[model samples]
Target: MKWFKKYHLELLLVLPMTFYILGFTLLPLIRTIILGFQNRYTGKFSLSTYQALFARPDFLKSISNTFVIALLSLSIQIVIAFIIALVLKQRFHGRSIIRAIVLMPMGIPTIVSGIIALYVFGTSGYFNELLFKLHLITKPINWLTGNFKGLLIIALADMWKVLPTLVLLLLAGLDSISQDIYEAAELDGANSWQSFRFITLPLLKPTITMAVLLRAVDVFRIFELPQVLVGKSVPFVSTFAYEEYDIGDLNGSGAASTILLLMILVFAILWLKFVDRGGSFGNDS
Candidate 1:
């Protein structure tokens, strides 16, 4: 009784969050897993839904497409964000304005970003119109057609939408680094490249890992951009799940979602293991 009284205030603070997780996140996940393993028609335990899901060619293609698009988008975003973060770390004229401009995309909704991409890259869009006016081509090229081209456009669009957030995260990580360390490196006659390679990158590994993992999960579950830009033409795992749900195949949708959840877990685990093997988080020393 005395111990309970002592901890009651702390428990009160935690209870709401605990209940919220169980009620919303855990319960929904449990329900999805159960549905994934059950026969839709009979409501009996079965693996037919997963088997059917795997048997579909488009489903397999979507799995590949999801990975490809994620790789492309993350590669572009990380490189650009890192460069921008590095530049922003230094003092310069109009730096605040530039940072604001960099962060502007985060305020735009995903659907709006998709629509903007469509306007810029569609058959009669600005890109094609500009090329035609410049006599670079006699006709407007359809940028959002063909499997690879369409996926590439979607990746670029995703990058534009998410890169600002990544830059912010990297900038926060960079800020946490000490100026004293850079000065020490200079005292050791280490050049800028050497300091960045040895000191900056190693210290920033944990932040980079976190940013990539979060973005990778989102990329694997990509739906809105592809759905808005090309619909069924550019199928992804999220879109596949949505199509199943739309067609009233709740069991199939559950199975696909379960697979996607597992994919995310496995990727996250593998990435953490890789990072752990390379170095400890935040501090290599």
Candidate 2:
């Protein structure tokens, strides 16, 4: 009875979370896999759905587009966010105020961010006006009309919305680094770039792994920004899946979703494995 009383609080706290995850998250995932495996109308197991899924040329284009957008945007955002994080870490006047301002985007939802992007990038928007006024162009350039340009606008909007959170994550990792190590490196005649490369990045592997994996997974499944900004004109996997499900092709949607899930899973597994092989998380460079 004493043991029961002691552990009951822990059990009560954990059981609800466990049940919620099982009921809502894991079950849905299993159902999705099963949905993807089933034939469209026959309700029998078959590979025909996936075969048809891959047979479409536009579907292939969407997959390729997703890869290009995800890799390019993530690479650009990480570099920019890390640089901003480094600057924020330096002691300076009004640093807190600057940080708060930079992090303002955290409160802006993706849908709202999409609206903002349209306001700023639309033909009648500030970007076109600025270019026209500066005599950089003869007329308002149609930025979203081109495929690469549309993807660029979407990527920029996503980066703006998510960069603050990434910077904060990197800052936390930066803070966890012992200053004594940097001081020792300075004593060894290391310059700024050398010190960062030798001490900062190596120590930041785990946190980088954490931040990148979280952001990569979320951004790779991007839908709202593209949907709100350009709608079906953009060929993202998420948008394609939405179209499939909208047309009452549940199995087709499931197959697209399964492919996207596998893409993310593979990237996550590779990232984790790479991080693990770089020695223990607690080891400082």
- Residue 192, candidate 1: Cα error in Å is 2.4
Expressed as tens digits, the lDDT of each residue in 1-285 for candidate 2 is 999899999989999999999999999988888999999999999998899999998788789878888887888889999999999999999999999998999999999999999999998998999988899988887777778999899889999999999999999999999999999999999998998998998888788777877888987899999899888777788999999999999999999999999988988777767655644433545
In order of listing, the candidates' clash counts read 0, 0
Best by lDDT: 1
TM-score against truth, every candidate: 0.92, 0.92
Least well predicted 10-residue stretch by lDDT in candidate 1: 275-284
Q: How many residue pairs in model 1 have overlapping backbones?
A: 0
Q: In model 1, what lDDT does residue 117 have?
A: 97
Candidate 2 has its poorest 10 consecutive residues by lDDT at 275-284
